[model samples]
Structures are given as structure tokens and as C-alpha cells.
Target chain A: MERKWNKSSLMGWQFVALPSALILLFSFYPMFQSLLLSFQSGKGTVYHYVGIDNYIRLFSDPMFKQAVFNTLLYLIVQVPIMLLLGLVIAHLLNNPKLRFKGFYRTAIFLPCVTSLVSYAVLFKSIFAVDGILNKMLLSMHVIQEPIAWLMDPIWARVVIIAAITWRWTGYNMIFYLSAMQNIDPSIYEAASIDGASKTRQFFSITVPMLKPIILFTAIISTNGTLQLFDEVVNITKGGPGNATMTISQYIYNLSFVYTPNFGYAATVSYAIVVMVAVLALFQLKLGGEKR
Target chain B: MKKLTTMVVHLFLIVASVISLFPFVWMLMGMTNSSSEILKGKFSFGSMLMENIHKLLDMTSLGAAFWNSAIIAIIGTVGTLLLSSMAGYGFEIYHSKSKSRLFGLLMLSMMMPFAAVMIPLFRMFSGMGLLNTPTAVILPTITTAFMIFFFLQNTKSFPRELLQAGRVDGLSEWRLFTRIYMPTMKPTYAAAAIITFMNYWNSFLWPLIALQTQDKKTLPLVVSSLASSYNPDYGIIMVAIVITTLPSVLIFFLLQKQFVQGMLGSVK
Candidate 1:
């Protein structure tokens, strides 16, 4: 990039300046404004900075606590299961002798193309008390009667978990499949020569090699789940008594659904920012990214 | 034993594939059935397709919703590609310490969840008197850090020799970027375009907040509203959801390779 005029350094700014300005205006400026709003109190127009009262209120807020609990429940219960299932499927499809790899890949990956709201609505209908699932179970004698799936609190949570897992497992599988392809086949050959079983090879070689990707997907899924507004908002509407209410939904409720409390909602939103930062750092350390 | 193991693997894949593909099939079947028939677990096609389309058209402005989504997705995707790529090229090609620090700051923006910025953004847009408009929905996401990251990662593989030769040919920096750089990076642009379009198309939360009016509502918003009704007609919902989901599906199938490449670019 060295030039006679010493112009390249200044020239690069011309390209980047507009986009940098836009990101600053939309992303950073609003982020700071949100942070400022979190510290203020009162609704709509009349508001003033009230120290950390909003932060203190967050501790005692039942709805906020419930939302956090439901979000963590999804992250703990759904993420590992989805990632493991994705890894297993990717491993299976990575087999050279496996037939119809393209078909399987496409079929599984097809779910990713679906919009979150669309799939959530579809899953809701499918799991309704008198819907296709209950009908199938009844015909097969697996259940003696139709279960009101979205009515029960526990089952409603399960339905949300299932819906998220169903939509995203295949999406994660694509990542693992590509990463697995990069692993040297000769490494597996050597491990087999040394009498490592298929299961052993997967655990030792494949899992270890895909650590960074696992960490990546885990963080992405965690962030996504924490902001889990769409599925819950659409599927259950945070119903069965806020059983599946995520923090994002709570933010929406605070600002829009309920009386306008953008101040407190911004406070709640900051909680997510802190949690995301903390969890991502924790995953990076746990995944042993030093190597 | 090994043969049995392989058979079991095959069976497992079959079940997984069926589960993955079943809803799509169910949605298609639902398109052809009435609401109550679908409720009673009828899984076969019926003669209600035309009726459902008729009802959907009568109930909502389906055409307007589709048009809104198309406008937002197309314009937003094109703007995102251009702006993000320019920033990416500047950061990578220049390779300065100050630029790297600035890039790091921009990357931090990626971690700022939309919820955090939603309230302020709403206020900002409303203050500008741009509520219920496509610009509000399109502006915030037009130059995302994630898309910029994608371009930067892809740019690392770009050949520097071309830039040297172009410079020798008296090509200005912007002209070189336009004439030489863009043509060589068509695949990257395509990949970025596919992913960006799908994102804008499928985006719900921001658009839901920004676009408040009915006629201005995008397809996802319309489908969501339709299903949120007290006594939703499953037939109408089926039609709406199918219409909402089809564009991304078609784009995905058409440029499946670039879509995958674009996604992979993020992590790499």
C-alpha cells in the first residue's frame, strides 16, 4: 500500500467513513442512549436520571426473574442437545458409504430457510390438543387421549424448546459437517489402526477438533435464546402465565405492550448485554481457545 | 453386527429427515384443506386451495404485504452489500493500527443485541417522523458489522496483485474498487446478497416495531397477525405462511452454494 504521495492511508478513510458514520449513528449512539435511558425513571416525556433504581428494581421484578429463568432453561436444556444432535448427524452423514447425502443434507437444512415466526406458528398448530401430532399418537395408541400441549406450563416450555431445536439443529449441523470435512481422513484411519472404535474416534478426534465451532454455535444460540422473543411471542404469546417469556419479550412489554416504560425496559435490555458478554467470555475460556 | 449398526444409522437418518421435512409437507397439505379439516388431523390434500386464497385476499392486503417485504429486502440487501464491502475493503486493504482499533469497535457492535437498541432506535425513527416507513426498517441494518465481517474475511483471500497492477494502470482507488475489485468478487457479493436478502425478508422484531400500519406491514408481520387472531382459520394461515416462506426458499435453492459459502464466511 506504500505510494509516492503518502495518500493510501488517508484514502482508506474515504471508503470506510460513511459506513462507520452509519454504524455509529444506528448502533453505537443508540446503544449509549439506551444506557442513559436505563438510568432514568418515569414514563414517556417526563423523565430524569434516578441513579440505579431501575437496576435495583430488576432484582425484585418477578417478571424479569421469570424471563431470565425461562431463557436460561432454554440455553441449558436446548443448546447442548441441539449441538450434540447436530454433531451426531454430521458424523453420520460424513460417512463415505452413506447413501443420499445430498438429500439428507437438504432435507435437514431446509428448516433453516423457514422464518422463525412461520415455523413457530406451524409448530403451534401441529401440537394443538386436537392437532396432527395428538391424532397420530392416538392412532398409534401411544396416547389414550389428546393432550392440550400448549395449555400445560411444562408442556408449553417443552414445545418452545422443541420448536427452537427443530429449527436450529439442522442449521448447526451444516457448520459441523463442513468443519468435519476439514479433518484429515488419515487421522481417523490412524486411530482405527490403533483399535479406536467409531464412537471413540468421534469423541476424541472429531469433538476436540470442532471445539471452536462448538463454542461459536453455543454463544450464537445463547445470544439468540436470550433474545428469544419471536417464537414465544408468536407460539405461546408468553402465555400459560409467562412460562416461556424471554427477556426480549419482557423488554417489548415494558416499552410497548404495557404502559410505556422505556427507561426500565432499557435497564432490562442492559442485563442481556451483560449476560451475553459474560457467557461468551466463559465459553471462550472453557473451550480452551489458547491453542 | 457392523451391518446391523449401519442399518440402524440409516434408520436414524431416515427418521431425522422425516421430522425435518414433515412440516414442509404438512404446510403444503394444509394449503389444500379447510380450517376444521386440518384441526381434525386431516393430512391429505383437499379442494380448499382456491377458497383459502380467496379468503386470504379478502381478509388482508396480501399483495401490499408482499410488495413491502420485497422493497425492504431488495433495497436493504443491496445497500448492506455495498456499504459493508466498502468498509471491509478499506479496513483490510489499508491495514493500519488505527483502522484495526476502529474495526474492533465496530465488531463490538455485533454483540449489542437488538433489544438493547430497540427503544432508542424507535425514538430516533419516530423523532425523524419516519415511522411506518421502509426507511426506518432499512436504515439501522443497512451497514451491519456482521456483513462487514463477512466481507473482510472473504477479502483476506483476495489477490493483492490485481490492486498493484490497477494502480500501475493509473486507476483511481474508487475506480479500481468499482471496475477491478467488484468484478473479481462477484461470488462474494452473490453470497453476501443471498444471506442479506433472507435476513431482511425473515426479519420480524425490528420491522414489527418500526412498521406500525397494516398496509405497510411486511409478510411476516401479516402472517403473525393472521395467526394471532382469536379463532384463526388454519387454511388462511397456511396460505399466508406459505407465501411468506417461499421467496427465501426459492432464493436458497437457486443459490444454495453461495448461501452456504456466505454463512461459512462469518466463522472463517
Candidate 2:
């Protein structure tokens, strides 16, 4: 029996050995090296042990501060709005009496499947000076002229936020919709019989039941927004004087676009890591991971 | 009052669906319109579809870029599903204390932003003389922590009785895995394949840094360069965007049911 137990354990290791090795080599090793690299300052390859110099520079760097502020603004504004929109849409779609449910779900979910470059290109054109949005507004006489959506500081941020909300609301809706299915129907029946309206039922019943998923989506969206790079880089290019620049894009610019400051970039990356970790912890505490 | 509420719900859904689908319709129309017409917000189709396609093909090495993207996405997806599923199965079914701890550590690795480790990864790839190669892009992502977590989560639903039955039939462990476990997880594999393929295909940042040469560039990078050029033609750019977006959409259409089921399994 002991020999048999030993054989099964060996078999287990055999199954996992290759993948574990790959993860160690590619994921963990690079992570450890970056943590070490964060301490060493240099251009390109030349380096010395700087010991927290990069962290010190982070406070003084205006670009870094702006990127952090922009990222935080997105986190505060976009995530709640997107998640709320997702919840409302999911609740609406969950209505058993609703028509064309599959069609609506598919259309809403299609945006998440689109290639980032394709959507960024689409959004950029849609918000261009003579783009469809401005054209519509003009025909409606809402604005006398085209709003340069991607040119101005405030409008550019609005465009970025709108683009993200458009793409991800459906994604979060899927989570809510799926979780909502797990809810028992009799609870809603009881609520309805007890003089509850649909809106009231949604608030009291649907919201409480979907708490775990809400928390899950919240943390995931927070992490995603903190590392928001692709949209800003592709659409605005953090342009109009870096108005919409995000921390992830700043890190990209530091390493690839500008002179290779590996240490500083690594430090900025850690800031994101720390921020996400703290936010996730706080969410879990408030959401109360109750089964 | 009931009639009014239903009308309101339907109106909201119709508006949302139109908003979601408008970009696609506009893109298709733009493909058939001239550059200036697109800039002018022409809502109608024109006689420029073939002309735009010809111009796109003539100007860029789009065929090579498509091939590069297809190869990387296919290999990356297949590798990710097989290896991550293996580890997932091993950790779940085998049930070792140390292995679970290791799995927990792996999950933490998922939270580490890719940007944090990208510089070191790039340096390592450069040191290995793989800077301009697709291998550099494929290697780092081939065994993603998220995929492993996904598989691990899904494996909770996989029945252990089948494994015991396979063992009693005198099959080797690896044989049972390949012949029985893999075949039984078709829906899960289908879902993972679509998601992984989309990720690898639409992946921009790493591939942008890794594949420097024009011939080695993926479709996204190619489209980006075209869109950014001085005096960019919106018609040709729209064509490129359509081409890049088509594959993921096609895969999503084909495998969406399984994809949703897989997601349900994970969340449950």
C-alpha cells in the first residue's frame, strides 16, 4: 500500500511537472527578477543598486502622478457606472416574460469579443471632429458645431471612459445574469405576493443574492482599470497633453516609447499591484464573503 | 400600467442593441465607401468595397500578418489548454497539500500586472536572442496563470469515478488523461479554446514589443501602423479593422454556448 501511494504521488508530479516548470520559468522567474530590477537604476543595461530611488522619483514625477490620478478617476467613475448598468441590464434581461432575450444578450455581449485595435479604431473615428456622434448631435441641433472629442482634455477622458463602459458593461452583465439564474424563483414569488414591485424586488432580492458576484466583478474591474492600457494607447494615445494617460500606459511609455528606464517602470508596476491588492481586500471586507 | 412597463423594457433593450450593433453596421458600410465619404459620415454603401480591399492588400503585407496571427493563436491556445488542464487535473484529482499551496501561489501570480514583469521578460528574451520572433510572444503566454485558474475551477465539476474506472481498465495514467479525460471535457475545451484564441489573436502590447519586423507583425500591429500613418485613409483602415475583427467574431458565434456554459461552471 505504501508503494502504491508512492507510485500515485509520482504520477501526480509527472502530470504537473512540465506546466509547473514553464510557469516557474516564464511567470514566477520574471516576477522575481522584476522585483529585484525595481531596486537597480540605470539606462538600458548599465545599472547600480539604487535602493528605493525609483520609489522616491515616483512621488516627484508629474507624469506618474497624472497617470495615477487618471487611473483613480476611471476606477471611481467608470467601474461603478459600468457595474450598475450591467446589474440593471441583467435584471431587465432576467425577466422571464421578456422577448428576444437571446438576441439582446448576444448583441450586448458582442462588444467584449471585438479586437481591441478594431474597437479603438471604431471609437476614434466615431468621435472624430466630423464623426457620426457630432453629426448626429449637429442634426439634432444639440451643438452648433462638432466637438473635438479626442482633442480636448476633458472630452478625451470622457471618450475613454465611454469606450470602456461600452465594452465592459455587457461583460459584467453576463456575470450578473448568470448569477441571477442561481436564485430561486419562489423567493421572488413571495416578494411579489407581498406587495413588492419589480424595482423593489430587484433592490432587496436580486442585489443581496448577487452580492458575491458583485464583489467579484468589482475587484476584477478595479484590477482591469488600474492596468488599463490598450484603449488609451490605441484610441487617444494618452494624447492632448497626456490627459487620459493611465498607469499601465505610462509604464509602457517608460519602457518602450521613451528611454528604457526598467527600474522606474518596475516601480510603477508595483504601485499598481499594491493599489489593486488593497482595493480588493477592502471590497472583500465590505462585501463579506458569505456563502 | 403593465403595458407601459413592458413597452419601456422593450424600448430600452432595442436602443441598447442598436447602440451595440451600430459600429459593426457602420464599419461594413465604411468598407464600401470612399475615405472622404467615411470622414463625412456617409451612412450608405458605395461602390468602393473591391477597391478598398485591393488597396489594403496592395499596401500592406496583410496576408503574412494574418498567417502569423493564426499560427501564434492556434499554437498558443492548444498549448495553454493542454498544459493548464493537466496541472489543473493533477492538483485537483491528486489532492496533495503541498500542491494546493503551490496552486494558491500560482493564483497570486495572476494578480501581478503583466507590465511589472514585462521588462524583465523582454530582457530575458533578448538575451536568448528571440527579440523579433513569434516564439517570444508565444512563450510567456503559453501557460497563463488565468487559464490554469479557469481549468482548476472547471475541474471541480469533473467526475472522479471515470478516472477510477479508467484505472481499473488497465490504462496508464497519461493514456487515461489523453483518451478519456480530454475527450469528456469537450465543452470546457471548446470554451477555453475560443477564449484563449481571442486573447492571443487580439493581444497587442506584448506582440507589439516582441515582433518588430514588418513581416513578423500581427494584424493588430499592422492595422495600428496603417491607422497612424500621415494622411491616413479611413476606408483602407476600416477594411483592415474588419479583417482583424472577423476571426474572433466568427469563433464567438460558433462557440458562444459552450463559452457561456464554461463561464457558468467557473462562477458556480
Candidate 3:
């Protein structure tokens, strides 16, 4: 039995060895290296240790401040609206009596599957000065002239928020819909028998039951928004005077587009990590994990 | 009142679906129109589809970009599924205290933002003389922690009785894994394939940094440069967009059932 146990344990290690080694090299090792890099200061490959200076520089750096503000703006405005829309849509579609269920679900889920570059191209054209959105507003007599959506600072942020919400709402909805399946249907039946309306039951039962999944989506969206890059890079390029620049974009610009101050870039990346970690912890605290 | 409420629900769903699908319809129309027509917000199909395709092919190396993306995505997806699934199975089935601790550490690795590690990873690759290579793009992502977690979650429902039975039948551990465990996990494999393929194909940032040469660029990089040109051509871009978007959509439509099931398994 001792020999058999040893054999199986050896097999277990063999199964795990390759993947664990890869992760250690690619993920864990690089992580430590970046942490070390964050303490050094230089452009490109040249560097010398400057402990905590990068962190200190972050406080007075106007561009970093603007990027953080813009990222926070998206997190505060977009995530809630998207989650709410997703939950409502999921609740409505969860109705067994709803018509064209598959069609509606598939259509709504389609956006998440689109390549980031494709959708960004589509959105840029749609919101261009002479684009369809302005044309539609003009046709409806809502505006006398075209709105330069991507050129104006405020509207540029609005377009970024709208784009993120459009792409991700259905993704969060899938989580809600799946979690809804686990709720005992007879509870809703019982609620209705006790003279509760649909709205009442949704608020009291469904919301409470789906709280954990909601928390999951919230944390995920928080992390996603903090690391916002693709849309801003593709759509606005943090243009119209850095109006829509995100921290992730700033990091990219630092390393690749500019003189490649890799240490400062690593510093900015750590800021994002800290922000996401704090927010995630807060969310878990509030949501009260069942586990 | 019941009739009114039902009407309201239908109206909401219809409006949302229209909004969701409008970009796709517009993209298809844009592909067929001239650049000026697209800029002018023309909604109908024009006679320029073939012309746009020809121009796109002429202007850029779309064929090469597509080939690079395909090779990277295929190799990355297959390698990720095989290795990560192995670790996941070993961790879950061969339960040990130390292994569980290691698994927890792996989960923490997933939470670290890729940007934080990008500079160091780039330095490491450059040190190894792997810069501007597709292997740099493929190697770091080949054994993603999230994929391992996904497989671990799905493996929870896998029956242990089958393993015991295979053992009794004189099957070796490796043989049982190859001949039985793998074949039985078809749905999970399909789901992982679709997700991994889409990820590798659509990946922009890491590839953008890793690959420096024009010939080495992927489709997204080419499309990005084209769009940023001082005199951007909407027609040609729409063609490129369609090409970039089609494969993932096709895979999604084909494997959607298993995809959703796999997602459901994860969140549960």
C-alpha cells in the first residue's frame, strides 16, 4: 500500500509539473520582476534603484491623475448602469412565456463576441461628426447641427462609457440568467399565491437570491474598467487632448509610444492593481460570501 | 392591464435587440459602400463590395496577418487546453494538502493585471532573443491560470468511479487519462477551444508589444494602423473588420450550446 501510494503521488506530480513550471516562469516570475522594476527609474533598458520615487511621482503627475479620474468615472457610471440593465433584461428573459427567447438572447449576446478592433471601428464611424447617431437626432428634430461626439471632451467620455456598457451588459446578463435557473421556481409560485406582484417578488426574492452573482459581476467589471485599454486605444486613442485616457492606456503609452520609461509604467500598473484589490475586498465584504 | 404590460415588455426587448444588432447590419452595409458613402451615413448596400475587398488586399498584407493569427491561436489554444487540463485534473482528483495550497497560489496569479507584468515579461523575452517572434506572444499565454481554474471547476462533476474502473481494468494512469478521461471531457474541451481561440485571435496589447515587424503583425495590428492613417478608408476598414470578426462569430454560432454550458459550469 505504501509503494502504491508513492507511485500515485509521483504520477500526480508528473501531471502538474509542466503547467506549474510554465505559470511560475511566465506569470509569477514576471510579477516579481515587475515589482522590482517598479522600485527602479530609467528610460528603456537602463535603470537604477529609486525606491518609492515612482510612487511619489504618481501623486503630482497631472497625466496620471487625469487617467485615474477618467478610469474612476467609467467605473462609477458605466458598471452600475450596465449591471442594472443586465439584471433587468435577464429577469425579463427569464420569463418562460416570453416570445422569441433564443433570438433575443443570441442577438444581445452577440456584441461580446465581436473583435475589439471591429467594434471600435464600428463605434468610431457611428459617432463621427456626420455619423448615423447625429443624423438620426437631426431627423427627429432633437438637434439643429451635428455633435462632434469624439472631438468634444465630455461627449468623448460619454461615448466611451456607452461603448463599454453596450459590449458587456449581455455578458453579465448571462451570469444572472444562469443563476436564476438555480432558484426554486416554487418559491415564486408561493409568492404569487400570497398576493405578491411580479415586481414585488423580483425585488424581494430574485434580488436577494442573485446577490452573490451580482457581487461577482461587480468585482469583475471593476477590474475590467480599471484596466480599460482596447476601447480607448482604438476609438479615441486618448485623443481630443487626453480627455478619455485610461490608466492602462497611460501605461501602454509610457512603455511603447513614448521613450519607454518601464519603471514608471510598472508603477502605474501597480496603482491599478492596488485599486482593484481594495475594491474587490470592499465588494466581498458587502456581499457577504456564502462560502 | 395584463395586455398592456406584455406589450411594454415586447417593445423593450425589440428596442434592445435592434440596438444590439445595428452595428453588425451597418458594418455589412459599410462593406458594400464607398468610403464617402460610409462617411455620409448611407444605410443601403452599394456596388463597392468587391472593389473594397480588392483595395484592402492590395493595400495591406491581410493574408499574412491572417496566417500569423491562425497559427498563434491554434497552437496556443491546443497547448493551453492540454497542459492546463492536466494540472486541473491532477489537482482535483489527486487531492493533497500541498496541491490545494499551490492551487490557491495559482488563483492569486490570475488576479495580477497583465500590464503590471508586461515590462518584465518583455525584458525577459528580449533577453532570450525572442522579441518580434510569435512564440513570445504564444509562450506567456499558453498556460493561463484562468484556464486551469476553469478546468478545475468543471472537473468537480467528473466521476471518480470511471477512474477506479479504468484502474481495475489494468489501464495505466497515463493510458486512462489519454483513452478515457480526455474523451469524456469533450464539451469542456470544445468550450475551452472556442474561448481560447477567440482570446488569442483578438489579443492586441501583448502582441502589439511583442511583434515589431510589418510581416510579423497580426490582423488587429494591421487594422489599427489602417484606421489611424491620416486619410482612413472606411470601406477598406469595414472589409478588414468583417474578416477579423467572422471566424470568432462562426465558432460561437457553431459551439454556442457547449459554450454556454461551460460558462454555466464555471459560475456555478
Top lDDT prediction, candidate number: 1
Ranking of all predicted structures according to TM-score, beginning with the best and ending with the worst:
1, 3, 2
Per residue, candidate 1 scores C-alpha lDDT tens digits across B1-268 of: 9999989998999999999999999999998999998888798999999999999999999999999999999999999999999999998887777888999999999889999999999999999999999999999999999988888988899998999999999999999889988999999999999989989999999999999989999999998999899999999899999999898889889989998887676675
**Residue B256, candidate 1: C-alpha displacement in angstroms:** 1.2
Q: Which ten residues in a row have the lowest lDDT in candidate 1 chain A?
A: A1-10
- Model 1 ranges off by over 4 Å: A1-6, A289-291
Worst 10 residues of 3 chain B by lDDT: B258-267
Chain B, candidate 3: TM-score: 0.97
> Candidate 1 falls in which docking quality class?
high
lDDT of 3 at A185: 97
RMSD vs true structure, all candidates? 1.2, 1.5, 1.4
The per-prediction tally of clashing pairs is 0, 0, 0
lDDT of 2 at A184: 98
Candidate 3 lDDT, A65-159, residue by residue in tens:
99999999999999999999999999999999998988999998889888787798789998989888998899999999999999999999999
* lDDT of candidate 1 over A200-286, digit per residue (tens): 999899999988898888888888888898999889999889898999999999999999999999999999999999998898898
lDDT of each: 0.92, 0.88, 0.89
**Residue B186 CA displacement from its true place in model 3, Å:** 0.8
lDDT string, candidate 2, A58-83, tens digits: 99999999999999999999999999
**Interface RMSD (Å) of candidate 1:** 0.8
